[model samples]
Target: MELLYEEAGQPCFGLPSALATAYGGDLGFTTPCLYANFVTSIDGVVALGPEYPSSGSAISGREPADRFVMGLLRACADAVLIGAGTLRATPGHLWTPDHVCPQAAPDFAELRKKLGRAAQPQLVVVTASGDVPTEHPAVQSGATMATTANGARHLEGRLPAACTVFVAGERPVLRMTDVLAALHAHGHTTVLTEGGPHLIGSLISESLLDELFLTTSPVLAGRTDTARPGLIEGFELLPNRQAWTDLISARRRGSYLFLRYRLRSSCGLGLGLSAACRKRCPT
Candidate 1:
């Protein structure tokens, strides 16, 4: 991978110069940056599913560059966020940076230690229904489950002791602001979401996403009537005049392209800007 464009930021990792060259530079995040990563086909299909397994890898052709970027971003996050559906879709998946690219595990761990972060980024699962697979490998190992009050009842004792369930919403719908507040309280300000469309839509709709890292694969997963979702789902954005963002950087490897965008206005007045989101965030 090589740098095609960069607005200006020195993201450093402790890897050897030759190994780190593909990533452009060492990467880090602001105190409170909520970014997302996705790999979509040229035709814009993020998954090859309603039923396909590990759909993202299929769409991405298991591209090494994509994995490198994913691992790098995960290494920088304080928490890895994902929706329940994403949890169910990849049964063997673990959200850790090392899991994506084990060869770079040492570098990832070194980067985290250098950044003053935990040994591993916390895994945060968001669900309105609390329908996450309790026995799934990721769940069993433990994760922070964010859901509605009603959903909490469904998850009560199903999860392992390592897991903690927090009610992020008072109503039927889950609120992203409350979720972020809970994460922030736990010292998790830099968030990285690996979504399944609906979750991305919810975050984007609420203006809670700070940045986006997208990998555009060379192939196409042509959509059909069977609900092959795009980068965002659940709500319409461009049609609703959602806030626009600016491209901050771009890179390319093989036939794939990695791009980054910074939202003009990011979520919840950022980390330390305000303690109460309601006072500054748009309703």
Candidate 2:
């Protein structure tokens, strides 16, 4: 992994020696904000749909550098947030810093301890339907599940003893602002969302996402009727509403290109900025 460029005025966590050496630079984040990480193929495919499992790994070809970056980001967060779809796709995976890149596990632990975080960042799953794979290993281990009232009723008594459920809203679609508020109220201030596109799209539509770390894998995932998706889905932002970005950093390892971008403020707030979402948007 090598740093090609990085912007100044970025927050610094002063990563432990081992992590810093492998990451090619220091990494940190502004507190009380949400950031998302994703790997897209050169042809702009983030997922190969439900038929393909662990689509992100397939997209990146499980590049070691990408995994290290994923682990590093997870290490810096107070919680790792994801949609139920993301959880369902990777049944064997754990949303932990070491799960993706275990080589720097001890260093990650040191960083977490120094920062006063939990042994592992809390795993948060957001699902409006609450129809996630309940028998998955990660769910059985434990996770904070946020869902709608209806979804809660559906999962009543079905979820394992380790999982705790929170009814965040009464929705056909969750506003995401409310979900962030619930997480904020719980003290998981710095969040990292390894998203399934629709979840991140909800955040972007709400103008709640602060930054994006994207790894452009040098591969092409051609779309078929299988329902491939890009970096954002569930909504579109174009001429009417746009969330443009500022490139804050860029890195490279082999054919993979790691880029960090900060989303610019939007003019059309949609159902988020206006319609009461603006006030609820987390800082």
Candidate 3:
């Protein structure tokens, strides 16, 4: 994959000069940062249909560049966050960077080592009902399951010992504020969410998402029905408060366009917390 637009050529991608400079280089976060990644059709449909269970793969047609980009983002994260639906949709899947792009495994591992990060980013699964597939391989491997107190009760002994269950709220509903604190407490400052729509909706509604990394696949899932979910779902941010974002970077490979947008502060959920939690946690 060649860079279409980065201005300065830098030493990256195991070469003296490489296209790695085109994409953002050396991503680091001292404070808690929440970002999301998604692949969507040019028409804005993120999922194809129920017919295609894993819609992202269908949406991107399993594009190698997309996979490489996914692996790259995963490499930079301290945790890979997803909803229970995403876990259910991606059966037998592992969130580690190498799992998605094995050819880049060494490079990804080297990047993490250079960044002083753990070998693999922790897997964080958000489930309100605790209705995750306990037998799924991803769940069996060490993961952090965030749910409500009632949900935690339902999941207590069902999950593997390797999985750490965090009860983020008293009620059955989850607040992104509490979730951020819990993750921060666990030393996950750079959080990446590969949402399943509703989760993205919740994060966006709470204004907690700091940035977004979206890949536009050159295809059309021309909305045959209302079931086709977009990049955001379950909520609307228009006609009253519209969340706006600024494009930070853009790159292309094949017909796919990779774009990064930094959500404006007015449109952001700015670490809204009580002074107590703010004092106890990293914002």
Ranking of candidates on TM-score, top first = 2, 1, 3
lDDT of each: 0.82, 0.85, 0.78
lDDT of 1 by residue, 41-69 (tens): 99889977758878998988888889988
Q: Which candidate would rank higher by lDDT, 2 or 3?
A: 2
Models 1 onward score TM values of: 0.91, 0.92, 0.87
Top model by TM-score, which number?
2
lDDT of residue 268 for candidate 3: 24
Off by over 4 Å in 1: 9-19, 267-283
lDDT per residue (tens digit) for residues 130-176 in model 3: 88999999889988899998888899789988989989967678987
Evaluated against the true structure, the overall lDDT of model 3 is 0.78
- Report how far residue 174 has shifted in candidate 2, in Å: 1.8
When superposed on Cα atoms, how far off is each prediction in RMSD? 4.9, 4.9, 5.4
Q: What lDDT score is found at residue 51 in candidate 1?
A: 86
| Candidate with better lDDT, 1 vs 2 | 2
